[model samples]
Target: MNRKKSIAHKLLDAIGLFEIHKLIAKHINQHHADIVVDYDLSLLRSAHLIGAPKIGFFHFRPKRFRNGGTNKLRRIGERLKHYQKLVVLCDEMYEEACFVWPHLKDKLLVLPNPVDLDSLLKKSACSIDFPENLTPGEYFVSVARLTHQKNIHLLLRSFAKARELGCKWSLAIIGDGEDRVDLLDLSKKLGLEEAVYFLGYQTNPHPYLAKAGGFVMSSREEGFPVSLLEGMALGCPIISLACPTGPTDILQNGKLGKLISFTEDNPDELGLAMFEISNNAALRKNYAEESKLFSQNFSSQKIAHQLMSLLRDIASNQRP
Candidate 1:
């Protein structure tokens, strides 16, 4: 799923998917299922075989609809016509989808990811060994994979610039990925060896999120990031890049948090955001309160009710 496959590999994957679909279809028929929901949109061809109304959900920004060649996008649009409805994570994506396939505008739905606020709050209270050098409410924290998409390198560069600008807070990154070594190298190259701590992946990142001075997201793209919502639920002041698809919606165009944009060669805007958040206590408190209040709108119960209503309508052969 990461890259293009050889023709032989593609053929094998297609055969395997067909078998899986057949088994799934048989199970649905035996169980008298009223609807079929595909999270990956791979079941489009198998919808008729399953003999049930089908819904497709995709979480990430689909690269095909954006940058993929014209022929591939046409094929994707054709495949999408089989679904009773398609759910995307944010309004920006909904607009993009409608623009790409105006014919299926009525079939598109915007549904942000839900966060279990109560559970996250409870988890944030659990006792864990925190770093001794970093004070709870004085260090910036980020929880994301160290990947090109997450853009940890930009964070490191921004942290460096913030440090030069007299921002005293250290940064704690709480995830791991293939780009770990490169990110670490960049951190050292920027002379942040002592100021930036790579805590790697944590089974429970909520404690860190709950106690940090600020939560920062530097992703290049996102589909309604759950981590951002978790940070909000934990009442951390937020600083996120105006990335594709999600951050703008989550931050409410910078009302709920500090939103910054950056170019490939310049991360000064992000640096200034970090510096401002570090220096201004009133700003942090205001953003934290607003973020906590806004996060309640995305609670599990509320979003679940909306989803259940949609499923019930679809199940009853009604358009939603």
Candidate 2:
């Protein structure tokens, strides 16, 4: 069945290495006396293995996969046991999931995920031209892989309802995933094919971010989403579902952007938010300014400095 193939592919992907990671690790190894890995950083384990210090990892929690069947976890644990130092970034803000893996509890650092803020900042300058018939400030945007976890369908329904209510704003979705076909069908069913534009996978999402009038996230759950950070950096006003562990914190409990209950499934709730951001230019401008300042902490330089500091600490204590 398809599920079997999916499992097989997951195994292979868990083992595959992207060329960029290889090049970076190879380059870093040349400088550092010994290299230690940060976990959940990538699916690829292409980092330096030659005379490297005991490899350490910074793991994400909330159980991306089961402990035994997950080859990625297995591989990471194998490395951790053999490596001199293993550090985990335990930003799996959902406390319920925290103690599930008792063995990993001691290693978890409880750190927030880091974003390549420099890249986002540089990309923020780029912009996309609005589609013909689409006017600036007349669109709401949600950039997320079309998937259940992201609740893209909820966004689509809300936007459709907003249209029905004569809000007249377009919703643009950027990113691709398994839920694409279902979402497209839902759009057609809701008569939103014209109003909802599905922009397939974008490797560099900055242009899309730049043109967007406002940003929205309707995730059911998340562990420090980078899209929110990228949106903040790009100065797009935001409206995110008040979800656990990520959005509320990033929004500073609705200070930076509107945070609503995940239980409110009515399109009107979502539509009202869309209307507020779309109609209120001042609020958008204020949000954009505040977001840019808030996003600085997660910038690449800051994260890289933190990583290097950890490296120094490990390198200093590492035994030959």
Q: Per-residue error at 266 for model 1, in Å?
A: 1.7
Model 2 whole-model lDDT (C-alpha atoms): 0.70
Query: Each prediction's TM-score against the native?
Result: 0.92, 0.73
lDDT of 1 by residue, 1-320 (tens): 71256878788888988898888778777876677779777676567677667788877675544456768777788878878989998887887778777888899998778998889989999998998998888999999988888888888998899999999999999999999999888987899988998999999999999999999999888777889889988889999998887888889999989988745446799999999999999999999898899999899999999999999989777434
lDDT (Cα, tens digit) per residue for candidate 2, span 1-320: 33367888766665554555567667667876565464654423443343466444443334553343456665655444444544443343535234444454444444456777666667766665547866656678788888888888889877776666677778888899999999999999999888888878876777667667888888877767778888888888889887654777788888888787764356668767877677788998999899889988777778778878877866787655
Poorest lDDT segment (10 consecutive residues) of candidate 2: 41-50
lDDT of each: 0.86, 0.70
Give per-candidate clash totals. 0, 3
Runs off by more than 4 Å, candidate 1: 1-20, 64-68, 318-320
Off by over 4 Å in 2: 1-35, 41-60, 66-97, 102-104, 110-113, 127-129, 164-166, 263-268
Best by TM-score: 1
What is candidate 1's CA lDDT for residue 203? 97
| Pairs in clash, predicted candidate 2 | 39-58, 54-83, 54-84
